[model samples]
Target: MMGKTLVLVTGMVTLLSACTMMDQPKSLAFRHNAVTADPQAAGTAQVTTRPDGMVTTTLVLTGLTPGKTYAAHYHAFGPDSSTDPCASNGPVSVGFPSFTADASGRATTSVSSEMARIAGDLGAYINVHYADDLKVVPVCAPIKMTKG
Candidate 1:
């Protein structure tokens, strides 16, 4: 009767919604913490996965040393998997091209990697290190999946 018809339509709608979700790729974002004396020092990373396993990552940072080059990479740690100091985030999952901050203390770069993804065993962190020494990690942001 009327109630049975309503129930069947709801079930069909739910199934169709799930199918649409499966067809879409995943995306994630990470916000960097201020690790330097400049309280405004911060950064952000946006990660999106393609259907073919390639990952596109974009980084934007501010309040850094002007004209100073900085190295950045993807690390093997999600937001819940690491505990501080940035050293504990594990090894680099993917290395990106170095970028130098502009005179206004801003830098933006986009890179693609076949070994990086928003999910699975590829890890989920975007790490920025000191220009002079890659050993010094000044900004570390763990990627958190925002959409799929």
Candidate 2:
């Protein structure tokens, strides 16, 4: 009887642990295109909600111009409902600080904003433009939300 009770307790503990793991935040991936066929740059971003209700995002990217500063922002979905491609992503939802690539052409930055989590905001995107000219969007990525 004691052995059966122990097994049941262990199973219950395992189930509870799994439930907690499911509550953990998720990360999203973004890939940039030089044109429509060539992959230019890529980035990964994760959104975590703090206990204070502030949402924080950490973004890391590679394949940028060395020693160049770039402007990054979060944009809403475009008018087209079928797709949220980078080229048509709507107005800026959140503007992040400018990032300067290292000599190796890599950058990592963490910014805190009121932007919602992936589950909460499925129509948002991360856009990276030339720092000198915000009008030129060289590389951009749609924030694809996923679960663990």
lDDT of each residue in 75-123, candidate 2, tens digit only: 7655544354465546677777998989888888777765453223433
TM-score of each: 0.65, 0.70
What does candidate 1's lDDT look like per residue over 1-148, in tens digits? 9999999999999998876665364444334455543345577776655556666778878877788888888766534344442444556778789999899989988888774343533455677787678766667776532212
Clashes of 2: 0
Off by over 4 Å in 2: 1-25, 34-39, 115-123, 144-148
Q: 34, model 2: CA deviation in Å?
A: 4.6
The prediction achieving the highest lDDT against the true structure is 2
For model 1, the stretches where C-alpha displacement exceeds 4 angstroms are 1-39, 77-89, 115-118, 144-148
lDDT of 1 at 137: 62
Candidate 1, residue 66: how far the Cα is off, in Å: 1.1
The per-model lDDT (C-alpha) reads 0.66, 0.68
Q: The CA-based lDDT of model 2 is what?
A: 0.68
**Where does candidate 2 have its weakest 10-residue lDDT segment?**
114-123
**After aligning candidate 2 to the native by TM-score, how far in Å is the CA of 84 from where it should be?**
2.1
